[model samples]
Target: MEIRKSRMADLPEILKLYEEARAFMQETGNGTQWGTSYPPVEQVETDIREEKSYVCEEDGRLAGVFYFSEGPDPDYAEIYEGSWMGSGDYDVMHRVAAPGRVKGAGSFCIRWCAEHSRRDLRIDTHRNNLPMQHVLEKNGFTRCGIIYLANGEERLAFEFLPKDI
Candidate 1:
């Protein structure tokens, strides 16, 4: 699969993928990370416009989407209860969505983010998101502890540094 910048045309597919992910989460007894109003269309549009969002294509079909950004993410600035792995520049990944067609999409996305960024990569997920936590751990992301009040809820944070490479 190849990863490329998301365009306006990919929005619909990305939305569908997120919906599928949400359904899967619900079926697995995991609370919805995006909730009912997650990933507003406007956010996707903005990410596309700013070229911070990306889509993964496998055999010419969109398989996944994610937002990669450098520097501090405003929402993640005041992590509660735990500190980040390092204090310098870092890339934060958000809104990663993958279709079932690709089993390891999250790993691919995380690897891409690590390689694309010059510094560390950090991500957070709901405490109940076991699948994501497993993926992160399998890919060498260390658990840095918990952060609260993002998207109106608490989350477990993970950080992958250059040393983890």
Candidate 2:
């Protein structure tokens, strides 16, 4: 699969991917994480406009999408119950979704992110998002601790640092 920055023309397909992902989450007992209208179109559009959104494509079809950014993300500033592994720069991955048509598309995207990152990588998931937790761990992310959103919604945080680092 190829990973590339999202463009305005890809908006429709990206929205559909998110919709299907929301349904999959609901069916898998993770409905509350994104609810019905989370990651609204405007946000996706903003991500595209800002060049932080990306898509995974295979043989001319989109298989996954995500938001990645360089961090000290403000929301991650304070961790509870544990702490970050390192004290330098890091990259964050968020809003990941895949339609499941291509096996390992999401995992591929995650591993790609880790391999390409110059700094450590960080991610978080809803407490109930077991599938995501599994994928993260499988991709070598370590459960770091807990972090709260602006509204106080708690999330299980994870981090990945290359062995050489």
- Top-lDDT candidate index: 2
lDDT digits (tens) for residues 51-109 of candidate 1:
99999888888888999988687766776676887889888898887747587877888
lDDT of each: 0.82, 0.92
How many collisions per candidate?
0, 0
Cα RMSDs, all models: 1.5, 1.1
lDDT of 2 by residue, 74-155 (tens): 8899999999997889999999998697999989989988988889999999999989999999989999999999999999
Query: How displaced is residue 68 in candidate 1, in Å?
Result: 0.1
Model 1 lDDT on a 0 to 1 scale: 0.82
Candidate 2 residue 48 Cα shift, in angstroms, is 0.5
Model 1 alpha-carbon miss at residue 91, Å: 0.8
